[model samples]
Target chain A: MNGEIAAILAMDGIASGAIYVLIGLGLVLIFAVTRVIFVPFGDIAAFTALSLASLETGGRPGTVGLVAVLAILATAVEATALVRNRALHRLPRALLFYLVLPLVPAAAVWFAAGTTLSMPLRIVLSLALVLPIAPLLDRIVFRPIADASVLLLLTVAVALHFALSGLGLMFFGPEGVRTKPLTDTVFDVAGLIVNGQTLLILAASIAFCGLLFLYFEFTIQGKALRATAVNRIGARLVGIRPTSTGTIAYLLASLLAGISGVLIAPVTTIFYDSGFLLGLKAFVGAIIGAMVSYPVTALGAVMVGLLESYTSFWLSAYKEVLVFGLLIPVLLWRSLSFSGTEEEEAEE
Target chain B: MKNSIVAAVVAASLGIATAAQAEITVGFVTSQSGPGSSIGVLYDRGMKAAVEYASSVGAEKVKLIQLDDGSDPSAATRNARKLVEENKVDLLIGTATAASTSAMVAVANELKVPMIAISPISVAANEAGDRWAIVMPQPPSLMVKIVVDRMKRDGVKQFAYIGFSDAWGDLVYNGAQKPAEADGLKILTNERYARTDTSVTGQVLKMMATKPEAVLLGGSATQGALPPLALAERGYKGPLYGTPALLNTDFIRVGGKAVEGVQVSAGPVIVAEQLPDSHFSKKISMDFRAAYQKANGMPTSDGFSAYSFDAWLVFLDAAKRAMATGAKPGTPEFRVALKNAIFSTKDLVGTHAIYNFKPSDSYGVDDRALVMVRLVGGQWKYAP
Candidate 1:
């Protein structure tokens, strides 16, 4: 292959790898803080993509309905908590924040769905619908089992993935939908064409990931999350609400997944069950980071993207076999290098 | 829902028991749920329309039973077994995919139930099939020949192939090779991918590096839509070709303008209006097309619907003659009679092709079964 063509292929690989970086950050954050595998990370991303397509078609995204249902359930849970604490006056506040909070954006989406608004506003509204899902699920399902074993949490996460995908099928119908590209400009760079979408993805990934790093380094809540990841009992003993930390981790992770989904939809057709594979690939990248370091995980994910691009060209039929085969050597080397981290089993 | 379905089944059985009548039972096992359901839904609509036509005209009464395989081959086999053993269906119709159809066919032959596959899962009339299985869809060889021939006429000789990593992909790749070699065309690269793959950028780049004259993508339904879109995004400007398995509206709808200028071989029923009046499939195809539109409330239809309609016609014609021999449908004698009748079919016109079956070739459509189509202006225009 010519140097220019190879340069473009590497760029394409980096573009795809950017998505994996977003998803890997989410998986690692959720796993470190909450000890949950976050198996449904990819499913939510796929749903986010479909929601944008639905908005583009002027139909209320199925996620708007999901947000409303989750809002109602969360309100009930908070109401029950208030009654047990004998804080009767706080019921309306709980109801307003939990139930009414979601409705405003959902209602805006409902109104704007069929209108020919600019693409950016519609995408923001689609993200508005998907962003709340992680926090709601963390509260309703994961928080209850917070003190449980990692194996149980992992199994439950897997089950949730299956349930969400089934519900996705029912809501979205059995059709694959593609959205218009955010930008159609193709720049001629060094005699090789570069897609505008690829540049957008790479820029957004770096900006968001950098913001996340700053948030953790400077903010009190970020330190609380870091402390919880380091030692949950220590954080709780220091008056940090471990539950809220878990909820925050979930919210950030979901935001990453949702944004990744909207960015990905234009490049490929999105379906109800397509998320599982994407999520699994991201998990593979996170594993390469030892599921703790953010930068390393993102780096590993980009390598995955480049490896996938080059290998598929060399051996098209064995692309998957080779892609998955990458994890074996990484695991072996990590195991040999970090033999002192045997407390991995005892900590979880 | 399960209770209600069982209640309905029981009530229907009671009604049949009181009437003391033997009804022809035909079981259909297809992917009514899961990723393959879109293709299954179309075949279901078309087959139901055919059944309505026969029932309204007062042909031999048929009791249709269906089971969902969820696009799983093992599930299809289980459903076929249940239909043959528990439901006692004399004839079986199933499966929109080649792999699931093979599973269903194995069960049908083992149970001695006459069967037909509505998709391009070709079943040769061999002793292994026990003369009990046949396919109604156009052969992959016949369909791929049209694309190769159309390309040959346009002075194209070399191509690249990227297909699914399954039976459907293998069929198109192997089938396209037969006519391609005859016309002195070379396939430079052969790539494969799973239907559920999130991207094919790697494969598209490999294809572009080789610089073939054209690329042939063999994906069924909307899954086939992905590769062309990816190829276009990579700025690979060459003619494109596909198989009859991609003859669905979803392919065009999801593929968008990127799929414009794509050429393929499809059943005449897809572009029935464009076919000449002298064409053999024109009249029957027009009738079938009208019925499908009336049933679906949509003007567009594809080879998926036509295959099942042709399967239904063949089944109805055979059931009519089999019933005349005083064979009760729930008996083994009825299945044997039906299989024999299917084998005896000759010159029976269908929406897709003429049904001419023999002991060794049950899927008996010749070159007339397929036509070349080009996607121009987001429409499938007849190219020949």
Candidate 2:
């Protein structure tokens, strides 16, 4: 290929890789903190995109109904568990977090669904509507099984992906949605043309990565999460609540996924089940990181995006196979390198 | 209301009203909850409209049993078997994707029952030469030939090809080769993408590098919009051509401005109003439209639902002929008679095409079945 074509392909690759980076980072964060694979991470992103599209088109996003249902279920589960543990004193706080917090955004969406809101407000509303899904799912599905084997949690996560996708269909319907671009500006970088949205995605990815680094290095809660990820037993001994750390991880990851969704909505059509494959591709990036290092995961995800773009150009029919096939060699190398190391099991 | 009344009047004039006591059970399996549901829902609504119209017309009583296969082939097979063995359905009609429909075709032959498939399966799978099953949609050979012929008329010497990496894609691509060769046109590249792929920039870039005269897409429904959107982004302004699969409202809506001026080979029913009033399919297409609106409370915008409606029409015709032989419903003799009647059908008009099925034929249409429509300002306009 000529230099121009190669440059264009690289641009496409980096743009898509940026999306994978966000998703990969979220997957790695959730897996480390919660010992849950969080297979439905992409679903959250897709829902966010769908929600944003709904708001843009003056329709009530089905995310409102989904978040409302999940919030109530979470509250019921939390309430029953607390009452059984004789922790009635914590009930009000639980209600505030589990019920009232998510409901505020849902209520906002319900009231503002059909109005011609500004694009920024619509985006914020979409993010707010989707932000609770992952954390509330933690309360409802993962928290009770917190001490279960990592394998079991993984199985449950996979099952939850199917259930959520089915629910995605019920909520969003079958038609795919692609929103208008956030901006119409185009840039010519020495003969390579780049759209404003691509620049936004690249900017967002870099900003989020920098923010994540700063937060981990400088913040108390971030250190707590890091400690929990490093050693759950040691962290517990140091008075770190695993459940609280898990919640924080989920919330942060949900935000990342939501941001990715909003960024991606205009670039591609978002469907109810579209998230699974996208998430799976990001999971490959996480695997390249050995499911821990954030920078390596981001790098790996970008590699995947570049590799996918190149492969599609060279071998269009086998693009998915080639992209997914990279996993085998990475897994083999990881196994060989870490053969004798004793990894901490997720189970208590 | 006016349309349904017209449909009723047409039904009365046709004299298809049969004895209500002789009931025929029809089993319909469709994708109601999975990836295929986008098209499956159309089939579901079409069958519902067909059932409603038949009842209003005082046709033979039909006990319609519908099941959701969830787009799984094994589930479709299980559902088909259950309908035949438990419900004793006289005929079978669906399950949306080609894979599931092929699975049902096997079940139909194995269960010794006649079936109508609403999706296109590979001819190898439909090798049951004795014909216990037949396809409702036009074969890719017939549909793609029109697109190729149009390409020839447009003075295009070569084109790029991009489609889904699946059976449907293979069907369209394979169907295009012979006609393209006959027309002396070259297909420069064959690129494929998954249905759920969020982007096709890589494929589009590859195609653009080849610099073909035009592009032909083998994708359908919402996924079909991907390549066009990518091409438009790259500012590739050559004409686009596709088959009947691209004739859906979601495709136009999703593709938006990028898909404007795309020419697609479609069933006559899609542009029913644009068809001359003397056209054979015009009256039935109008009736089907009215019946669909009355039953579903919305207009039918895709070509898929008409397949189901045509399936019902064929079944109704066959059922009437089968009963004329004095065979009781739910018996093996009745099924055999029904199969024979369906195979011998000649000049039977429906919304999409006039079907003339023979025992050896898997598909039952000719060139008269297709019309070319171009996407103009977000609506499919009759191009010819």
Candidate 3:
């Protein structure tokens, strides 16, 4: 209730909210680009943290095995499609993209296992290990039904989240882990000490947002993704392949999740099942954006963080109820504001 | 005719002797794959160690039929039913969480089999006329009383409370109320967080604003470390206390420097090596450690797992008495005998506590079941 305590709580809220923003951005981006909700975004984030924890302990991360299995599955699916289409010439490209590229990080992690690596190296390796998961999951689970109804895709994505969580338990052994803080510095401003980790998290969130803006505004690939997000069929008509754009969306979104994972891991314990709740909280932010606007989503995510922090201060037991309760009013508002939008056309 | 009657009596006696040596099947249900899996795996490991120990020590062959409930209560029910009706187990033990354990309680009663519950269940669950379940772990009230007693001794008037927002949390919070009141202590705050909550900064901040002399956490396993870590981050240095649920290696590993000096009330088995030589639990606790190391390939490092070991000890004792009644292992008569024998368990020594159960009692341990422990240098040191 006091000014110093309020300031500290704000710092905590913003720091955690920044993580939600990162995850929300990924959720909104993926939802726009591929009509899939990408429920497993938080799982990827959690896996990144677990990977870093494994690296810190000088053990082989389970991500290597997970990515390898996904890569093989994706490759087999692609190879079978190629043979069915009698496009033998495209086989080599398929093998490289599906099989070889995904395995590189797994191999790196395999080689890095049990040897002491610097923290920066471990973070990079963790990010790389998680990068292939979302994209390859797209190939194996989402590609065949790429044009399916949004509801169906959402169900599949949710199921994939559970499966990955179960796999996470198998690999991580049910113990929660927290890595060492990225920085130990603290700042004193007006009689309040602010943790350096909070500053780093805010900085990372802002930097990623700025970078994403630049990529979307300046880069051709990013524009292609935006075009697909705007109109999948129209983008395809103009020569942008939705499949490639979808893959790009997954990769970029996963990078956001990966970064958020690394940022949040030191602050709190991350477990195999921890991702679902985080992702769901961010989804509340995404819903506020109507699954469309990035800035609105980011703002809503921060509001959620602030709301959560304040609510917990006032009513700790009902904190989750209050945080999740925001969605009802937001959904009501979204429905009122976006009533005239036409639904997507179903393609055979 | 007399000679034929003598032969028939001899054959029936041989049949009864063979039945006494038959494999006694005991079903184990535990959460192996869900949110509860962290604690569930500990129970599973302890049960494995118990099976090995029983085989080596007892003359009777003990067959353990294990099933994973995946932390689901309904699944626990199904597994318990399968174990009893199909496998025809003589006794039941399992499912780590209270809800799932309670789910198996009904099955035990309806199926006429005795169950040794490893988790604390509500009083209503055991209030049935034909109750067949008895708890292994110390009741939360008894454990919380020790914490409250220590608070009284330390001259602490009020303390902040943070715990999981589940039944376990409610159990601890409610358990502390009467004891805390009697000890002239006041509870300042009641903050709760979920097991999967990534941060408890909000809850911690709220609790710290009250500025109590100490903090008592009702959380268990790895999640128990969250509040302490939050408190440490804010540099709130004060005495911390918790129930036996906090006495685990994962709690220490995750809490790290923050949890040091925090005292917890736990089963004496946790600090077995630190106990006096004459303590009743000391020998069995040491035996449990050896069996655990042999079976799990590591030393026992948790308090939850030992409950399973103790449950096994109780079952072995009761099953021996049940067999003395000349009932076949798979028959209904043997289940009744086992149930009666379990209810009559008296003065049986186990790793955690000396066993004593009554027909109407759900929890059997007294004050001897608990020990106050403190974390120093990342190890639980016996503080009492």
Q: Which numbered prediction scores highest in lDDT against the true structure?
A: 2
Clashes of each: 0, 1, 1
Colliding residue pairs in candidate 3: B29-B95
Candidate 3 residue-wise lDDT, B1-384, digit = tens: 999999999989978865653778889999988878878999999998887787622466777889999989999999999998888888899878788998898888777788989987753434356678889988888999999999899899999999998888988899899999998999999999887776788888888889989999999877899999889988889999999888777788878899999999988988899999999989998989899999999987678889899999888888888888888788888888988998899999988888898877878898899989999998889998
DockQ of each: 0.49, 0.58, 0.49
Tens digit of lDDT per residue, candidate 1, span B1-384?
999999999999987874543778889877778767877877788876676556421355678887889878889999999998888888899886678998888887778889988866656444564567888877777778878888889899799999998777888889888899999999988898777665687788778878889988888777798889889887778999887767667788878788888888888888888888988888888878777777777754667777788888888888888887878787899899988888788888888888898767757788878888888877888888
Residue A275, candidate 3: C-alpha displacement in angstroms: 0.9
**Predicted candidate 3 versus true structure: per-residue lDDT over A50-72, tens digit per residue:** 99999999999999999999999
Q: Write the per-residue lDDT of candidate 1 for residues A1-348, one digit (tens) a residue.
A: 667657766887889889999999999999999999999999989989999999898887888888888888888887887899999998888787778877788888887766886898878888878888888877778877888888899999999999889888878877888788899888887777777988899988998899999999999999999999988888889999988898889889988998999999987768888999899888889999999999999999998888877776678778778878999999999988985654446655
Question: Would you list the C-alpha lDDT of every candidate in the order shown?
Answer: 0.83, 0.90, 0.89
| Candidate with more favorable, higher TM-score: 1 or 3 | 3
Chain A TM-scores in order: 0.95, 0.98, 0.98
- For candidate 1, the docking band is medium
Give candidate 2's error at residue A184 in angstroms: 1.3
Q: List the candidates ranked by lDDT, beginning with the highest.
A: 2, 3, 1
- The CAPRI class of candidate 2 is medium
Candidate 1's error at B325, in angstroms?
Answer: 2.7
Which ten residues in a row are the worst by lDDT in model 3 chain B?
B122-131
Clashes of 2: 1
